[model samples]
Target: MGQICPSTASPLCVGHRHLRHSLLSHGRSKAPTEFPDLSFLPPEMAISILSHLSATELCLAGCVNEYWQELADSELLWKGLCYSDWGNIDSFLPDGMVPIQSYKRLYLLMDDGSSLFNGDSVSGLEFLLNNGVVGPSDRHIGCFLHESRRLHADKVLRLLQDRRGVLDELVGLLDFHDVFLPDALRKFFTEVPAPKVRGDFLEHLLTKFSRRYFECNRDMGLPQDTTYVLCYSLIMLSVDLGSPHVKNKMTKREFIRNLRGAVQGTPGDYLVNLYDNIYLHGHVAKKSHYKVYNNADF
Candidate 1:
């Protein structure tokens, strides 16, 4: 008669008990093992090491095992990201969240709620600070207008009267890393106090986007017209921020002069060159090929 080993089908024939320990040892060695001695590190050390990973990478780390999962979702780790990325979270704390708040949900709110697909259309001031506004698209133009109607008088006036409204500037949408959008927008939006007039908003945008462009994308070889597209859009939007003067229609010549003025006023040397190149090197109205954009294009 023989008995089976607990983990194996091999029979322990009569008087073969001495072989059992060796068999058990061999079977146990086959179990999976994680990285050696990781758990030995103190929690603070662990948090410091793991904090360098981006949010996406942190999520992958959490799947390794339960202990690693806890470390990945550690409040200390996300707190660092929240402060580092979005600045002090105290300002964003909602009313109901009394003693504490979920940094993860707050992160999602900033990240997800900013996208065109996910967020509600908030006021220009709030939207700029939150990084929740998207640049205009065919469908988005109407949506932006709709949002304008929903707000209070101050916010609505700020939107329409500010020269750097959704129409006037793309804000940080083009130049910044989307992850840093919330913080970047907040810092820059706060740099200048609420602007009472439209031109001030345009000036802020020209200054800000130009500086950011020079800093980040200066070396990038953007096409002449592509560069012109940005210049034209900003210039046109600024000049046409409010209702176009019905008394005297905005003519093509007036628009071009406005472009020149905006280009001259912008801070970057390269931006000035791009504007010059577009106006001089290429015939903007070559052979009467100038395409007219109606109000809808704006």
Candidate 2:
């Protein structure tokens, strides 16, 4: 055979070249595509981007990875959300009460629906009540009372004392058919306010709210006893609705039985009607004969 050309040298050389080519091709095909890393972004830019996300969206973003978690849990972000949902946090906090957790935790607590009912026990309630920039209104106060059903009387007293027009708001809570005045009162008096203040407040509540109910349902043939004890009846109904010892869902008999002792001499039919109306509508039924009383009458 003619002398082997150097280019065709040995079978091993050809095999080596083929193996090298295969390795290069495989490396090129298997290479991972590069992606832009959010971690490389400036923290301020990252926070600014995350600021647009809602509380729920931010929570989901936090689960993505470590870097995003840091940005998602930023106090600024949460504080902003808290401010948006509930104005200045400091305005609502009781004089001596301080938050026990991060703004993030506080926001989450407020975001939870159950927190509205658990205010008495949850420490987060300290920051949950928000009076807004201008301050708390009757509607806001009523809502606060409704949400803070279990809040301590002392704390509620402090909150109310600091605010103007609280008595009017407290009465307004009753005027609206939707508010559970009994539970609201129970929450405010869990520990009881000063004797004079308590007396005046209850008197106002009884005079205004009870009289309104009476005026609204004057044509219903309600017993005078029902009218006289309507405020007391509301208190008893609150106990029935809130007391852990009693069944949550009460029958007509159970409802009447619970209130009959307090509202003695009121007919069962009247009591049942009152209970159904108050429980279902937060006030007695208003008939066509209902008359609007002047504020002076209260």
For lDDT, the strongest prediction is 2
What lDDT, from 0 to 1, does candidate 1 have? 0.44
Model 1 lDDT at residue 38: 28
lDDT of 1 by residue, 205-292 (tens): 5455445644455455433334334544534433343334634544445545655554453435544443444343332211211111
Looking at candidate 2, the ten consecutive residues that score lowest on lDDT are 289-298
In model 1, pairs of residues that clash are: 163-198
Clashes of each: 1, 0
Model 2, TM vs. native? 0.34
> Residue 245 CA error for candidate 2 (Å)?
15
